[model samples]
Target: MKSWLWLLVGLWPAFASGNDEAAELLKRVRAQHSADVVVSRYEIEIVRTEWQRTVIMAVTEDQRGGRYQGMVIAPRRLADTLYLKRDGRLWMVIPRLRRKVGISPAMLSEPWMGSDLSNQDILQGDAVIDDYQHRVIARDGDLVTIESTPLPGRPALWRRLRQQVRRDAVPVRVDYFDQDDVLQRRIEFSEVGEVGERRLPMVWRIVPMPEKGEYTLLKVSGVEFDPTLPDDAFNALEQATAGTATSP
Candidate 1:
């Protein structure tokens, strides 16, 4: 019994060290993707077996408060459509309806504009470190895999997440799992390049599980980090009124 107790005590520090390393690695990963503000354009392509649809949008994000505003600017029909997120709440402005509707937490997991990306995925921003409890699960070469569980009382759609990040702090792939621990989707990040003072992935491929040969590709363009954003950027009322006036 004495030897067993000693062995356990001797292994405790190694476990603690692994967790500490995981936290530090995650911190670095977050820093690489962090900015005061980010302005970018995204081309989202939804490829199906029978058809393909593409949408273009301008995105402005305030990293500090996790506020984001996106305006659809393509396809003529979706033009002037707006989405605003602030303080963990999302609102959508439809030009045809001339009203802004709030998005409930239950609907956050739904696809965004028929794309594989979810509404929650857009609003997550840089809050992963704060929303999940992480531990190092595996390490291979220069890549480290971390397993994360949603923190108690946090509003998260994925019950668990497994992310593989490079030693240079670039996220390569992330797998999302549901409450029943079933894998739902995976997002792969690539096209690493220098954006301002940091390196980031400029392309993201999202694939939903159990659906073969179907995926959504999101390509980032015109990325500007720490750009000045308008004060009313995330205001739902302002966006709704603008959509109403600019409806064409």
Candidate 2:
């Protein structure tokens, strides 16, 4: 019995080592999506059982300061609407009302313009890397599945998240769960293609909870990485006052 106990103790280090390797692998997968600066044109479609609506927007991200900004350019009526995030602050600007409103922390979970995506989803980029504790839960062929739990005191909407990533560092799918361990949504990534120096999914399909017939599709129409984005590109007031439409 003592011999068996010693053997188990000796194997414990190997288990700890495996956990460390999985954490590092997860980081590499996240790094693939990171960029110094990124500018892209996106087409968002909100599909319902009886109707659908489409919106086109130009989005820019400055990874250094964790800033993101988007401006609506299409559908005429919704034109010039802007969403901005800088250093953890979020704001919305409406051109017609000439109003710039600050987004409260509680509103982060609300859907963006009736789409399946939440405001937090757009503003919080790569947050899983730092805000959650990750571990490898399973592996199949070239794909690795990881489960993430929010670290202590971290402010996250989902109680847990599961992600599947390929060996080539591409994120294939992600599942979000609530505090009761109920699955809330699933996001699938596809259309792998070259975007600047890296290959990324150009299409994202988001399906909300309860298997509803509604879903949201986001497609990247154009993208440029590490471009010389203007210093005030993420300033909500500057963008609203300019009243200039951006095209891909």
Candidate 3:
């Protein structure tokens, strides 16, 4: 019993260090990608067995990387459609119909705009630190690999995330796994360049599991870390959705 206790005590520091390292690394990565408020415009190319199309969008998000309001910029059919993510929930505003619809569970889990990225994926980047227990599992020189498990009661559906990032916090790749530990999809980051003061991925490629030729690509065209946006900036969209827009 004494020997076992000593063995357990000796292992705790290594375990604790792994956790601490993971937390710090993730925080650094978040700091680089997140800011007070970020406005970005991107193009998405989705190629699947049944369809292929491009979508252009503009998004404004808060510092947490969780809350966002996005508008579809092109493709006349879906044009002007607005989506809002706040408080871990989703809502869609239809300008032509003049109504707002709640989105959760079913809608959140499905592919977004027919792309491999789900609504959850697009909105929950920060949840890695905010709602997960992660630890450094391995390290190879400047490349460190970590595994994150969803914290209890968190809204994320992914069972685990295996992420490989550089020492400087720029992510190289992330593999998402399902409850059975089966690979669901993987996102690869490449074409790194300066986005303001941060070195960020200019192109993000996501391929679903069972490894087929199907893939989705997101190209970040512009990114601005602006903290100047007023808190009430999104109110117009909200009020417009409710058919209660007030003239200023």
Candidate 4:
């Protein structure tokens, strides 16, 4: 009863192997997902060149492998963010001046607000089995277009990622390619179901090279998973009370 594989953290991870219907759609997304994830409050809206000029609001709480607290409201600098994950280490907290930033791995590729939210695309399912390597290449109706790449000296940033998963446990749609493969980015998944037990991805539209005007639209309006978040709200005095909370 315990078997949940597949784990690729975005952009590039040119994995192989196809046929067998991508191994039964990676065994139904590793038996309905579970790599740890917890969210109590959720609200993300970031649109840079699709409608609203610049609007970034985020209120999050995560506790999977441990820690991830956010507070980012933009209009002119307002960030009270903190992302922790003890033992394995990964910390970041910035309240204007209050510090605690140390998230390496080459910063995942940097660019969260300038778009394409990296940091391994918000820590994609945590334990990424050696960064990526999956197969399956086609299927339409219920999607399932996997393809990752990167494993030998990984310093990836789109070398392959044509994922469009959803074999019942939805929440996916990816397409980012570089290293001569072109296709910059196009990850669109709007309002997918289930949040409590998993099956995430409420909404995310990041089209950076599609029409060429630079794009970044993320929407996750309301999602509750693992509720009851209080552990000092995430220490550091809630990152200093998240710099005086704001944005509904």
Best model per TM-score: 2
Task: Give each prediction's root-mean-square deviation over alpha carbons.
Answer: 10.2, 10.8, 9.7, 16.3
lDDT of 1 by residue, 27-89 (tens): 666566556676778788898888899998887776666566778988799998988766666
Q: Estimate each model's TM-score.
A: 0.81, 0.83, 0.82, 0.29
Q: Per-residue lDDT for 86 in model 1?
A: 65
Clashes of each: 0, 0, 0, 9
Q: Give me the displacement of residue 171 in model 1, in angstroms.
A: 0.6
Model 4 Cα lDDT, one tens digit per residue, 1-248: 01101122322222233345654555455544333443433334445554544544544434353455555555556544554444344455666756666666676567654555665555553444345566766778877677766556755655776777777745376777888999877777776657546565555677777666555665555544445656565566344334432211
Collision count of model 3: 0
Residues 1-248 of candidate 2 have per-residue lDDT tens digits of: 00101111111111222367566665555455556777878888999888899999887776676666778988899998988766566678878877777777687788988888776665554443455676789999999887777768877677988778787866788888998999999888899888656776778888998877899998878887788967667667455435543321
Better of 2 and 4 by lDDT: 2
Q: Give the distance in Å from residue 27's predicted Cα in candidate 3 to where it truly belongs.
A: 0.8
Q: By summed lDDT, which 10 consecutive residues of candidate 1 come out lowest?
A: 1-10
Distance (Å) between predicted and true CA of 39, model 2?
A: 0.6
> What digit string (tens of lDDT, one per residue) describes model 3 on residues 1-248?
10101111111112223388877777666566655677878888999888889998887776444456788887888887887766655677776876677765666677778888776555454333455677889999999998877667865567888888889877788888888999988888899888767877778888999779899898888877764777686774556445432221
* Minimal lDDT window, size 10, model 3: 1-10
Give the local distance difference test score of model 3. Answer: 0.68
